[model samples]
Target: MRLSVWRIKYTQRSCSFLRSFHRSFAAAAAAGDDGKGCGPGVSLSDLRRAPACSGPLPALKPTDSHTVLIRTDLLRPGKAPEPHPSPDQLQDRWDDTHVKLPCSEHNLFPTDRTTDQRPSKALSVFLQGLQGSEAQHMFGELLSAMAQLALRAPRLLTQPIPLLRTQRCRSITLSQEQVSCLLANAFFCTFPQRNSHQTEFSNYPDINFSRLFEGSSQTKQEKLKTLLCYFRRVTQQRPTGLITYTRQCLQRLPSWSSSEKQFGKLHISCEGSIEDQGYGMLQVDFANRFVGGGVTGSGLVQEEIRFLINPELIVARLFTEALNDNECLIVTGAEQFSRYSGYSDSFRWEGDHDDQTPRDEWQRRCTEIVAIDALHYSQFLEQFRPENMSRELNKAFCGFVRPGVQPENLSAVATGNWGCGAFGGDKRLKAVLQMMAAAEAERDLMYFTFGDADLVKDCVHVSRLFLVGSVFRLLLQYYECVCKKTTRSRPQKTLYSFLSELL
Candidate 1:
């Protein structure tokens, strides 16, 4: 017997293919055939009953041994300053535990080419802008605020921030003011061992603003405007809310075969975006393993665009280590600051976004973002291997599962065709995998298809037709039949058609 291998390329026809299956299923259901091997579908109204995931914020104080809260008392104005403030006061006391402060003495600013002065051309550009006509009125006030932040860096960030390394479940919570001071130092390129040539922090995402300032592109300029706007706003009025970053590691993997979880309610749509429509839900960041993936450089996509709108998310790079398979980073209280239009190459910074996202019990913004990187495939067919599928299943489970929170308390996940774009993932397969994971985690899902109405209709049909275990079993069969040894080529049928026929 010969098995036919399929190379799954993302194309428009896939949507039509799913539509065909959907039509067939609907016809069978209408004919009173009992929709054999599938269950009654879920409705949008039923799914809405599951409350949006909110509340139960992490304790205001670091209640556990693994959590660290950066104390903010010293940040108060008129607080006694630390004695003997040497010129090298802000210098890095480098070690395994602490983030190397950008304002450190050893981290010299690149001298300007014209005058060989400190504060490289990039930093000078922004500093000069503070004095330019547009900001001339507030120049003195802004300059004083920035100076105060620079002077207080060493005193505020006194505790050694533990690096969120692999397999360690730890959290760091800091006041938004502390975040501002740290970002100010980044704007000045004061962070050490973060240049393109430097490898000291190679495993971590770049945090300094140098990369964002060096290149010249319309997108780059727009990004700078957004970031600069954030700085301006913070300087004028400091934020009092706190933000928390938790690195969660799953110790035991779920047994996908034996799980009997049913699919949760789904709210599928093709019109609105996850950020806008999925507000107050567990927003999913289709992330890169490095976390902030290319936001500091020339890349812009779902993850980067999200980071730009919510610059506070960028600070996660300072301490978050590269994510391992079983690990994910959950961020709560990072406020959004910008709203934009377009995507990737066409991305433009539209203007300021006033984040009125209400605060939780801990005085942190009621925003929760989960970062889970999908596996990138060189060849599209490589994703069909059972191991790869299992990895994806576990990865989504790690992101969706809330350990201490009861199933009823879990917030619904807002996601789209995760890993389907540049990663060349099959939207149909990924949607099923995510639904299954969300089901096992016992949470509803809000799926955004960007603009694929056919996908919206097809997924709604699938959610209505099948149970989680049935779909899981069918997917296993798909791996067994389609992924067996054979020549690699495009398949005549999609996973949708295969399941449709089987059911």
Candidate 2:
């Protein structure tokens, strides 16, 4: 056959090619630069004197305009400060006096910062670039704002919350104006850096602003325009309304042995983004343990892209330590500046986003978000392990819990496909886990499956059954009745099919 002849010819040609490659490699190894054969030829002194190995490495130029002084705590070499309450314990230290500080720290920055001392080398570099831009008039003003913020409340940058101590999450209300100032600081790459790698400042990996100014790419240009718009808006007249940033982390892990679960009254739905529908309640940011992940560096995905659109969240990098599995970060008042189409690498900033959320009594916008990091499964099925499930359950319970007698005060949870995209988690499994956690916390659930239509119908069915009994009891009922009936009469049913049977 023609196939047999072609196969013989292909094998013969490949063998000949390999032999030729081997001969070339052997010849190259045998011939030394000194014309010697397969023997050591060059002396250390000769190598040092050679043309290629003769010069000192280029030195970094020091800035002449200002003295660079980076904060010591920001450079804390290893492990983020010991997690508060020692990770295993719970603490409720919230009181009226702790809420005294108004959210907007704009007064922390002044309009005139002409002093010679610069807080960081990064800030100095940023100033140099600002001089060439059309927005030069706002440079001195922005610097003054940065100096006022950094100098007046040096403690804000220095004294991070010692530990994850509070039982109930607290909200820090910041004005749109204050957010603009802080964002402008982050935009210019003012934050201190340990190095380019994620080794040293692991908790703050995406803290620098270097990547924003690196290339002339369209994404970079659009991002720049968005920040420019924010700066211009704030300069014209500082936005009057306030935005809130809430810090959420577990005070203690939830009980796994408890048989009595509280499946409280709830309203659940599945649809578009949590940001668009869950605007008034607490939205979930499926985040990284390091908080911002690589938003300020190279990453551009779920949470990282969110940070890009709302640059104010980048400030959280300055203070948030590395998170424990049970910990989560929450920000309430971040205003989205740019609207984009597509996901990750295909992401394109379409136009400006107008945030019209009304402010509360404290002047903070109704834009609460709880940043919970889901487990990433490299092997896919690893997420099904009992221990991993327990960890996620505790994490979500801590986030959903509201410490108060009144149920009406607690906000419902809005989330979906938490670790399903880049993390490779099963969509069905994560949705079930979120539901179980919400059920235990007695909070309503709102899921956005990111356009998975089938999940919407399945979630509706599962939610109805979930409302009938405790999470465990419902599971027991399904196993006892649903499984028994299905296995004897028909083929083994899938998890979704079994759960939907209860409806």
* CA deviation > 4 Å runs, candidate 1: 1-59, 63-66, 70-93, 103-132, 135-148, 196-200, 485-488
Segments of candidate 2 deviating more than 4 angstroms: 1-176, 193-200, 241-244, 256-259, 262-271, 467-493, 498-503
TM-score of 1: 0.82
Q: Model 2, residue 412: what's the lDDT?
A: 63
What's the residue-level lDDT of 83 in candidate 1? Answer: 18
Best by TM-score: 1
Candidate 2 lDDT tens digits, 438-462: 7677666667777677776666444
- lDDT string, candidate 1, 1-503, tens digits: 22222223213234544454466557546734533223323333444322344535454455553544444333333232221223244334667667766444444544533112133444446555554665664356665677678567876675556788889888887777777777777665556666643465778888776677664566776777777778778887867777789999999988875575767777787778878877777899999999989988787999999988888888898889999999999998888888899999889888889887777665667778999999998787678776888899999999999887877666678899999988888898899899989998889998988888778767766765555555665676676676554466645567788776765
lDDT score of residue 233 within candidate 1: 83
- TM per candidate: 0.82, 0.62
Q: Which window of ten consecutive residues has the lowest lDDT sum in model 2? A: 42-51
Best by lDDT: 1
RMSD of each: 7.2, 25.6
